[model samples]
Target: MVIDSLLVLGGLALLVLGGELLLRGAVGLARLLGLSPLLIGLTVVAFATSMPELVVTVAAGLEGRPIIGVGNVIGSNIANILLIVGAAAMIQVMHPPRGLAKRDGAVMTAATLAMIVLAFAGTLFWPHGLVFLLLLGAYLVGSYVVERRSGTTEPAGEAAEALEAAPQTWLPAVGLVLGGSVGLVIGSELLIEGAVSIAKSVGVSDAVIGLTLVAFGTSLPELATAVVAALRRHADVAIGNIIGSNIFNVLGILGVLALVTPFEFTSELLVFDIWVMLAATALLMAILASGRAIGRGTALAFLAIYGIFIFVQFDTGFATAVQSAVGL
Candidate 1:
């Protein structure tokens, strides 16, 4: 048990380090290829931060535990909004950039609604997965075009700074990208192994493990990035990171996994967790639309909601009782 615990921790550490390195290398390569910073931020950096989730979900799907894959994506999206954004806002009031609140915010809400609609389909197959990928591609292209038309060249603030600081040399950059990709792959395998072992030992569902431990572990990179951005008073960057990540979690990670192996919806996921995710997302959008910063009080409320969510996951009885009382 101790060995598995240690392995999970080690894997989490590797994921964080690997994600940073990957972002650095990818940003350097994008710059070398003359990609605009805005485009790079919307694509490369956003995707890099989500690599851990992508790797874990794909690994879980390949291992035939599709529930874990789906759960990880749903859990990560919830965590991104509730935990990451809430914690960051508590550090400092998060005032999102106007353009992001208008554009990316709308896209995130639409993507989230799309997920809810897709979930009702009961199972996600290759055709559905292809649709997700196509939507994602269209979103990227549309965002790029919009930014170009509006002449918004600046990227998400601190995130762009971090990428701009990466090594400019092509060889070392390529090495970092390759090394990071390898590290992410190995770390994901170890993480999934440890999680499955621990789940079996504790007699818990794989979805529970994915929803809590696996989800939190894979989200470390975003947490770190958001906290750092918040401290720097770049709240837009922090908020942008969470929103962009949530979008990618659903569209990119799940889409890729579904392409490789179809995932059937678990009843608990459909009944409770997916709605919770949508609610959390809705809360974020409401806050953003209010044209006010996410203050300490609101942050505390978000944290409390997340704490209740985690508790419900572990105590199925509590979840069931609540659902019954609510007539769900």
Candidate 2:
């Protein structure tokens, strides 16, 4: 069990390192190809950062842990808003645009509401997949449309950021990406195996692990990125990283899973975790709409909320199962 835990942790480390390398290589390649930074950020960078969740979800679904696959997405998004953004704010001030609360926030809210509605409707199958994909298409098209209407060569300040990268050191970048991506897959395989082993050894369910460890493990990059962005006073990167990553976790990660696994929604998920996810999203929206930018205190509040949620999730099951076994 100890060995398995070590392997899972080690695998996660490699996954994160690989993802970072992939991002660097991808940025260089995009620049060499004359792709705009916003294009790269929105697609390449966003996808690269989200690769861990993508890899892990596929692994989970393939391993018949579809709950983990789906739960990881919800947990990661909640962590993105609470833990990641909160940790970022603890480092520096984050003044998200009021427009973000109005626009992208609405989009996120819509997605959350849609998922809830689906959950209430019973199992999420192909129809849910189609809806998710359609919304994803709309988002991509909307971004493109907005960019075109602005009539700007790049989104505001994007051009300046594009020129800031070093020259195309594509050779090493490619090597890193390849090595990292391979390592990520290998690591993901090992991590899932270890997590399952540990869960069984300790008498925890796969869903619980998905809600906590696997979910938290997959979210390490978001936490790290947000922390760094906050320290650098790059709150846009922090906010964008969280939002973009969440979108990809659903639209990209789950999209890939559906393509292969056709995830089946479980009563366990609807009863236990999905409501928490919706509440967390709503809380984030409330925070965004508060007219006050996220600061240290706001971040602290998020951390507290997340901590409470985690405790409730674990404590409930632990009490029920362990107490029942003990004839309590």
Candidate 3:
């Protein structure tokens, strides 16, 4: 058990390092190819930070533990909203970015709903995955077009200027990409092994571990980005990041998992957890569309809700615990 814990910690560290290197290398390569920094920031960077989740989902699917993949996506979405966005708002009142709710937020909610419909069949196969990929592609292309037409400079302009200063040489960039990929593959393997062992030891379902441990592990990048953005008074950026992440977690990661290995989700997820994810997405949509600042009060509510959600996953006495904690 201790060894498994070590493996999980070690794997998490490597995943973070690997993802950072991959992002830098990809951005450098894009720059070398004459891609604009805005494109790099909006597309490459968003996709890059999500690589950890992608790797884990694919790994879990291929290992015949497909529940973990689905749970990871569901859990990550909940964490993105209740945890990441909440923490960011606690740092600063997050005002909605203009038109984000109408577009990306709408898409995110749609994606969550779409998953519910698809997963109701007990299994989602490659065809379903293909459709999801197509939808994701449409979303990306449409976003790029709309952003271009609007001439949005701030989003393109203020996307971590340091990202532009990547490796100038092809050799180093290639090395980073290769090294990062290797690390991701190895890290994912170790994480899965440890997670499965931990699940057995704890007498919890694989889905539960996936939702909490693996999901949080993959979400580290998003959390760091949101916190840092909050400190810099760029809370909107953090909110937008969470929105994009939730969409990708559903469409991109799950789509890829479907293709790699189609498997049935546990009833716990199809019935309960997915609905929780949908509720979070809907709540986020309403919050963003309100065009008001999300302050510390909202943050505390989100955190409290998330705490309850996590506790319920591990304990049968959730209602009693909540009552005791809230003095109700």
Highest-lDDT candidate: 1
Query: Model 1 clash pairs?
Result: none
For residues 79-116, could you state the per-residue lDDT of candidate 2 as single tens digits? 88878888888888788766666767777777777777
Comparing 1 with 2 on lDDT, the higher-scoring candidate is 1
lDDT of each: 0.84, 0.73, 0.83
Q: Residue 11 of model 1: what lDDT? A: 84
TM-score of each: 0.95, 0.88, 0.93
Worst 10-residue lDDT window, candidate 3: 153-162
Clashing pairs in model 3?
none
Residue 144 of model 3 has an lDDT of: 76
Q: Evaluate residue 37 in candidate 1 and report its C-alpha lDDT on the 0 to 100 scale.
A: 84
Give the C-alpha miss distance for residue 233 in model 1, angstroms. Answer: 1.6
* Model 3, runs deviating above 4 Å: 153-162, 316-328
Tens-digit lDDT track of model 1 for 1-328? 9999988988888888788888889889988899878888888887887899998899899999978888898889889898988899899888876666677888888988888888887788999889889988898899889888988897866457757677788997898899899889889888888889998898778888889999999988888877887788776578877887888888888889889998887767877888999899888888888888888899899999999999888896866775576576
Query: What is the TM-score (0 to 1) of candidate 2?
Result: 0.88
Candidate 3: tens digits of C-alpha lDDT, residues 158-238: 246436546888988888888888888889989999989999998888889989999989999889878888888887788
